[model samples]
Target: MRYSPVLDRLAGLGGAKWELHVRARERIAAGEDVVDLTIGNPDVPAPADLVEAAVAAMRAGRTQYSDGRGEHNLRESLAARYAARLGRPVHPNQVLCFPGTQTALYAVLMGIAEPGCEILVGDPMYATYEGVIAASGARVVPVPLRAENGFRLSAQDLAERIGPRTRAILLNTPHNPTGAVLTAGDIDAIGRLAVEHDLWIISDEVYEELVFDGVTFVSPLARTGFADRVVVVASISKSHAAPGFRSGWCVGSREFADRLLALSETMLFGNQPFIADMTAQAVSRPSEAARGMRARFAARARYLADLLTQQTALGVHRPEAGMFALVDVRSSGLSDRDFALGLLDAGVAVMPGSAFGETLGGWVRVALTVDDDRFRTASGRMVAHSLSLSGQRAEA
Candidate 1:
């Protein structure tokens, strides 16, 4: 049996994170008390209004196939939202809705990048980006987002990595795994570089509404001079706690938006009409769902960060925003993978930092999607595991 070489390439991507998640789930199903925290799947209930909107849409006979560019009303709502958020005029024709941000990302990568091209992504990025880039026949060039620098991409690093082969830069704010939000200065630097090198910017603002504390999110599209080249992708999945809705959209220049719509037509025809209508309802209505979710997540993150800091010797970097934090487990004298497995045995599950990128070998990502009680239990178990490992090292 043979497969395309692309399949072989994807096989090496994702870095075994899924395998760990599956193992933890099997343990739980076998009656083991596993405190799984590997994935960022939100456990919060979907907004009642949004759920009702979906039901009403179905009742109103919106289940039919939609136009290849998504429902016109939904696209218009997204354009208006972006216009208010970015302070720039975004037309309905410049918005392309998709089933998920991942799908939108793939479409943008495939549309803008050709074979043998390069896409620059920050290190410690979401693993799915690498898989999508590989599937598009383009290589991923990682720009290291070092822990010493708070896991933020530096302008100098970006400039050094850009070459004739570099066609796009994928930016994730309130970044996954590390929870590092890009500062305003960072956005400015990146926008300037994109214009200088004539590269497309695929800004994943999925976590745009999940910022913690008093921090404000600055989108790449808000940066001047790169409006024509920046494709902003976002969803209600994180912001509205409706991942099952599979609703997201891509906003860019009118020309680029049409390319995304064309690619979407051949790939998915269009997003589910009912889902689009439901998403439009969520976007149009005034609601505090995002604020409530952000507050809950911030509390969970702070509780876990304090526990890790006080109960263990591990170096903890508290997240500025988002629903996850990174802990430096190198002090345990174990690889990040081994440390995570050890924690699983101790009854808690986490993702090894290496799953994000090779440069993150000494860390582990702890998600705050669990409830307060579960998170407290998991934090205690993780602390105990760290202490046990420290004792063993002392004996050696």
Candidate 2:
């Protein structure tokens, strides 16, 4: 039996990176005492009113197929929200709803790039990014997001990577694995480069609402001149604590949306109308959950960073926003996988940096979504594991 070449391109791309997280879940399900900090599955629930909205829609028979462009009201709601962020008028026709940001990204990538083309993306990106570009038959050219620069993608390095085949530059703000938010000035520069090179800018702003105090998120779309060249993919999953709902959308120029409408319809005509109804409310209002989450995540990140640095050689590359914290374990004299496996044995589970990118070797990512108590315990265990790796802690 033969399969699509895409199978090879996407082979072992997603779940493989999450293998340790999966193992942690299985062990916990079997009654193990592990403190799982592997994935950023939010600990909060969707806003109560949003849930009721979905129920009301379902009872109203919104279960039928929706237009490929998404529910009109939902698209209007998203447009209004993005209008404030982008500082411009946005039309409903420019928004295409999807099951989630992952799907939206895939559709956008397919619409913009294809075989023999390339997408310049940041290293240490979210795990599925490579697969998404590969699925579009586009090569991923990784630009280093160095720690010294706070993991913000460098526009100069990006300019160096540009070639005839470079079709686009992808941006993820409040970035995954490393929660560095790109500054406004940098976004403007990058947007200028995209304009100069005549390339697309795919901005993933799912964490737009997750940014912490004192840190602002700047989108290329917000930089003014590059509106037509920039497309944004975001979801209510992280912001509204509604991951299970799987509701998201793509925002771009009306022409870009028109060109992708055929693909959106062919792939999945539209997201569930009930889900759109729920997401409409989510997009229209400020997310109380996201505000609380930002405060909690910021405090928890500080707590864990202080704990690791004071007690062990491990130091955290403190995040300005997002649900996860990155711990640099280079002092432990072990690879990221070794450090993560050791933490699992010490009754804590986390993601190795290798899962994200090779540039992150010897680092591990820990989710800040766990409750304070469990997170504290996980912090303690991680410290002990670090000490054990340094031969400073005796095995019990």
Candidate 3:
């Protein structure tokens, strides 16, 4: 059966990663151990208090339908927590809760970007962004984020890409696939451009707390002029390892929040009361668990970068934050797909750079969301194979 071209456009986007992950699962099922790193799921446990809160909520019969936006208490808790984290006060009405950040992002696009409206997005962004834009019948104009520039877009680059149909710009910090955090200056420039062009800003800061080496995260909304047009989407998934709960929120002005909340209501009927309860508890406490999570990711990131660099053929973009590395494997004399598949065949798993976009074809995204020993083992094999490939090329 034939499918829509839009469906076809997404055909190979994420299938390969899971295809490899599933193959790894099969091997383990058959007693052949494999180390999988393709998925960016947190391997850590959620805070004990938060888990207890969810259990308590379940016992207290909070498993029913929640308000379309969220529970009043949860929304209020979110506003206070975010305001403290952001160093700015946010009214409770401005907080709109959803199942997760994915829903929040999709709802924002559906509510804001009209058909044929252009969204300026990063080339090697999370693939779902493309899917969301396509589902909305909007076009995504990918701006180049060169590794030479640490995978960041300059204000000039942003300015050059703006056009008549452009509706908004999607920004991800401690970026996925590369983990390149945008500097405060870069964010200021983006805000200035947003103000100058009267465009909307959709900032994804899910990895805000995962920054390392004194890297501070500043949101576009932190700027004065762009506040009205900015929509900040965040989740408790990475921060608290509660992805299963599907707890996330979109923070901004009341009008934007209301519009998105209404869209979310139509999309999901209502948020889960129990999940809201758990997330509310998480937001209220702001525990040491967040710090523990970041430290683990940072250590793994340092280990992987150091190990990969030992092999002259394997080049890794040092992860300033988050749990991933964009390792250049073209130097290993293999296409991204082949390199990923080869790793899978050798009892390892990883995501090909092409999954993000064509411009990143020479790389593979290494996820550090696994046990340290397993990650180290996989990295060693990859590096050894990469060096062998380089040696062969040199001999030729």
Cα RMSDs of all predictions? 1.5, 1.6, 2.3
Worst 10 residues of 3 by lDDT: 9-18
Clashes of each: 0, 0, 0
Please write out the lDDT profile of model 1 over residues 227-336, one tens digit for every residue. Answer: 88999888888888888888998988999877677688999888888899889888885446678768877888788778888888898777877778788999898999
User: lDDT of all predictions, in order shown?
Assistant: 0.86, 0.91, 0.82
Q: What's the lDDT of the predicted structure labeled candidate 3?
A: 0.82
Question: Model 1 scores what on Cα lDDT?
Answer: 0.86
Answer with 2 or 3, whichever has the higher lDDT: 2
lDDT of 3 by residue, 36-115 (tens): 78777888877787888888888999988778778888888988887887778888889888878898898888888987
Model 2 poorest 10 in a row by lDDT: 387-396
Point to the candidate with the largest lDDT: 2
lDDT of the structure predicted as candidate 2 = 0.91
> Distance (Å) between predicted and true CA of 192, model 1?
1.2
Quote the lDDT for 369 in model 1.
Answer: 87
List candidate 2 segments past 4 Å from native.
392-396
Error of 1 at 32 (Å): 0.5
